[model samples]
Target: MNQMALDKAAVLAEALPYIRQFSGKTVVIKYGGAAMAAADLKAAVMQDIALMKYVGMHPVVVHGGGPEVSSMARQMGIEPRFVDGLRVTDAETMAIAQMVLVGKTNREIVTHLCAQGVKAVGLSGQDAGLIRAVPHRHRSARTGEEVDLGFVGDVAAVDTAVLETLTTAGYVPVIAPIGLGPEGQPYNINADTVAGAIAAALKAEKLVLLTDVEGVRADRDDPGSLLSRVTVQEIREWMADGRLEGGMIPKLQCCITALEAGVNRVHIIDGRVPHSLLLEIFTHEGVGTMVVK
Candidate 1:
C-alpha cells in the first residue's frame, strides 16, 4: 500500500484495542465551552458522540448554557450575577435559565446528534427526578462569610435508572442542569456538578469535561505547560498553593468527586480542538489531562 494508506491503517490499528476495551462501557461527557458555542464545532462533537454510540460505547452528555443564559438575561434587561464562580439565580433568572438550558440548548444539541443519525433524547435534571437538589451556600471569597446563591442547587441525589434505561435502549441522553428543590422550585445547578453526580450515580467508566482551555498546566501563565497526566494530590496541591483559582477550582473538585465515587478516570480536555474527543479516546496521545487517583 502507499504511504497515505499505510498511515490510515496504522491509525485504525491503534484504535482497535481501545475500541475493544471500551465497548459497552459508559462515558459521561460534560459538553461546554467553545465546542458548544460554534456551529461547525458543535456539529463535529455531535458526530463524535454519535460515532461513539455506533462503535458500541455508550455515551451520555450533560451540557451547560451559561453564555446563552447570560445573553437571554441581557435581552430581558437583567444583569447576570455571580458569587464565587457560581451564578446567582433569582426566581426570574431561574426561569430564564430553565428556558435557555432546556428549551434552547438541549434541543440544539439533540438536533445536531439527530442530524448525525443517532437517537438523541433531550432531558433535564427535573425529568424522572433524575437530579434531586437542595439550596447551596458558598463562603464569600473576600469576607469569609456564607452567602446564599439564590436558586442555585447542590445535588442531593441522582436517579440512575433513567440513564440506564436510555442507554439500554440505545439512546444518547443529553441532559440540562436544572434540578428541583425541596419546595418543588426549579433550581439552576452547575453543569459540572450535575455531570459528576450522574457519573458517580452510574459508576461510569469515564467522566470527560470539554472546556475552553487546554488541560491542566504546570504554570498557569504558560500555554505550553499543559500536563497530560495529573494526580488528585497534584490538583489539591495546586489549590493549596493558590495556583488553581476561580473557575478551575470547581472543575478540579468535580474531578476529585468523580474519582472518589469509583469512576475509572476523569479527563479535562480542550473542546476548541476539532475532533478532540476521538483523539483523546482512540489515540495514545490524549489531547487532555487525565486525572487519576
Candidate 2:
C-alpha cells in the first residue's frame, strides 16, 4: 500500500475506539486558560467540539471568562479581587462578569462553532434556570470566620434539561458560568465547578478541561513529570504528601468530583497545542492526565 493508504488506515484505526466509546454519549468540556485568549487555539478548540458532535457525541461546553472579565473590569476601573481562589464578586463585579461572559466570550464561542458547521447556542446559567446557586461560605484566611462574598456562589444544582434539548436538536450548548441564587441575585460561579456539576447531572462520558499545562505533574516545576493516569485514591495520597497544592488543588478536586459522580473519565489537557483534544481522545498516546474513579 502507498503512504496515503497507510495514513488513511491509521487514522481510521485510531478513531475507531473513541467512536465506539463516545457515540451517543455526552461529554462536558470546561474551556478556559490560554485557549480562550489565543485565536488559533480558540479555532482549534471549536473544531474539536464540532468534530465530536459530527461523530455522534453530545458535547456541552462550559466556559470561563475570568481573564477576560478581569481585563474588562480593569478598563472600567474595577479592581479584580479574589478570596480562597474564588473571585470576589460584588454587584458591580457581577454586572461586568455577565457582560464579559454572556455578551462577549459566549458569543465568540458560538460563532466559532457555527463557522465550523456546528450549530451552537450561547446561554448563561440564569437562562432557563439551568444552574442554581447559594452564597458560598467563605472562610477568613486568618480568623476562619464565614465571610460573605457578595454574589459569589457555589453550584447548588444543575438542570440538564436545556442542555439535553439542545444536544437532541443537533445543537451545541455553550454555557456561561453565572447562576441565579435563591434571593434572585445573579452569582458568579467557578467554571470548573459548573462543568463538574453539569457533567454529573448529565452522567457525561467525559469531562475535559483545557488549560495551559500539559497535565497534572508530580513536580509543579518539572514539565516532563506529567502523570498520564490518576485515580481518586492516588489523588488523595498526592494531596496528603503535599504534592498537589495551589491552583492544581482545585482542578484536581473538580476532576475527582466529576469522576465520582458517574463521569467515565476526566481529562486535563494543554489547550495551547493545536488539535490537542483530538490527540488526547483519539490516539493511544494521550496528551493529558486522565482521572478515573
Candidate 3:
C-alpha cells in the first residue's frame, strides 16, 4: 500500500478502541461562535456528529445563536445591550433570541444532520419543559445590588426523559438554549450552561464545548502554554489566583459543574479546525483541553 493508504489505515486503527469504548455512550456537544457561522465548518461538524452516530455513539447538540440574534436586533432598529458581557434582555430581545435560536440556528443544524443521513430532531428548552429555569440574577455594577436580567434565566433543572427517548431511538437531539419558566414564560439561557446541565442530568460520558480559541492557555495569549489536562480543584485555584479570568471563568465553571455532577470528562476544543470534533475525540493527541474531576 502507498503511504497515503497506510496513513488512512493507521488513523482508522487508532480510532477503533475509542469507537468501541464510546459506542452506546452519550456525548453532549455545545456549538456556537465562529464554527456555527462558517458554512464549510458547520457542514464538517455535522459530518463528524453523523459519523459518531453511525459508529453507535449517541450525540446531542446544544447551540447558541447570539450573533444571529444581534444581527436581527440591529435590523429591527433595537440596539442590543449588554451588562457585564451578558445580554441585557428585555421582552423583545428575548423574543428575538428564541426566534433565532429555535427557528433559524436549530433548524439549520437539524437540516445539516439529516442531509448526512442522520436522524436529527430540532428542539428548544421549552419543548416538553425540557429546561426549567428561573430568572438569572446579576449584581448591578454601579450599585452593587442584585438585579434581574429581563428574560434571562439560570437553568433550574432539565427533563432528560425526552432526550433519552430521542437518543434511544437513534436520533440526535439538536437543542436550542431557550428555557421555559414555571408559568410558561420564555427565558434565554447561555448555551454552555445549558449543555452542562443536560450532560449532568443525563450523566453523559462526555461534554464537548466547541470554542473559538485553542483550549485553555496558561498565559491566555501564548498558545504554547495550553494545558491539555486539569482537575476541577486546579481550576478553582487558578480562578482564585486570577490566571483564569474574564470570559474563561464562565467556561471553566461550566466544566467544573459538569465534572461535579458526574460527567466523566469535559473538553473545550477549538471549533475553527475542520473535523475538530473527531480530532478531539478519536486521536491520542487531542486538540484541546480536557477537564476532569
Candidate 4:
C-alpha cells in the first residue's frame, strides 16, 4: 500500500472508537458564524453532519442568523441594537428575525443536508411547541436597572416530542431559534441558549457550538492562550473577572447551563477550520475547548 493509503487507514482506525461510542447517541449542534457564511466551510459542516447521521449518531442542528437578520433590518431602515451580545429585539426586529430564520436560513440548511444525502427537516421553536418562551428582561450591568428588551425571550420549557419523533425516524432536525409565547406570539431567542435548552431537554451526549474564533482563551488577543479544556467553575471565574465578554459570554454561559442540565460535554470549535466538527468528535486531540462538569 502507498504511504497515503496507510495514513488514511490510521485515521479511520482512530475514529473507530469514537464512532462506536457515539453511535445511537444524540448531539445538538449550534451551527452559525463563519461556518454558515462561507460556502466551503458550510459544505464541510453539512458533510460532517451527514457522516454523523450515517454512523448512527442523531445530530440536531440549532442555527442562528443574526448577521443576516441585522443586514435585513438595516435594509428596512431599522438600526440593529444589542445588549450584552443579545439582540435587542423590538416588534419589527422580531418579525424580521422570524422571516429570515424560518423562511430563508432553515430551508437553506435543509437543502444542504439533502444534497449530502441526509434526510433533514427544517423547523422553528414555534413548531409543535418545541420551545415555550417567556419575556427576557436584561438588567443593566452598569446602572443595575431593569431594562426591557422587546420581543426577546428566554426558554420557559421545551417539548421534545417533535425532536424525538424526527430523530427516531432517521431525520436531522434543523431548528431556527425563534420561540412561541403563551399568546402564540413569536419571540427572538439567542441561538446559543436555544441550543443549550434543546440539548438539556434531549439529554444529549454533546452540545457543540461552532464559532469564528478558536475557543475559550485566557487572553482574547493571544491565539496561543486557547484553553483546550475548561470546567464550569473556570468559566464562571472568567466571567466574574470580565475575561470573557461580548458574544463569548453567552456561548460559555450556555455551555455551563447545558452541563448543569446533565449534558455530558460541551464543545466550542472554530468553524473556519475545515472539517472541524469531525476533528473535534473523532480525533483524540480535538480542535476545540471542551467544557466539562
Candidate 3 backbone clash number: 0
lDDT of 2 by residue, 103-144 (tens): 999999999999999999999999998999998887875578
> On residues 1-293, what C-alpha lDDT tens digit does candidate 4 reach at each position?
99999999999999999999999999999999999999999999999999999999999999999999999999999999877677888888999999999999999999999999999999999999999999997897668898888999999999999999999999999999999999999999999999999999999999999999998898898999999999999888988897877899889888988899999989999999999999999999999799998
Backbone clashes in model 1: 0
Off by over 4 Å in 1: none
Poorly placed runs, candidate 2 (over 4 Å):
1-5, 140-145, 240-242
Q: Estimate each model's TM-score.
A: 0.98, 0.95, 0.97, 0.98
Displacement of residue 275 (Cα, Å) in model 4 is 0.4
Note the Cα lDDT for every prediction shown. Answer: 0.92, 0.89, 0.91, 0.94
* lDDT for 67 (candidate 1): 95
True-vs-predicted CA distance for residue 141, candidate 1, Å: 0.9
For lDDT, the strongest prediction is 4
Error of 2 at 75 (Å): 0.9
Question: Model 4: which residue pairs collide?
Answer: none
**How well is each residue in 118-175 modelled by candidate 3, as lDDT tens digits?**
9999999999889999999899656889876798899999999999999989899999
Candidates ranked, most accurate by lDDT first: 4, 1, 3, 2
RMSD of each: 1.0, 1.7, 1.3, 0.9
The local distance difference test score of model 1 is 0.92
RMSD of 3: 1.3
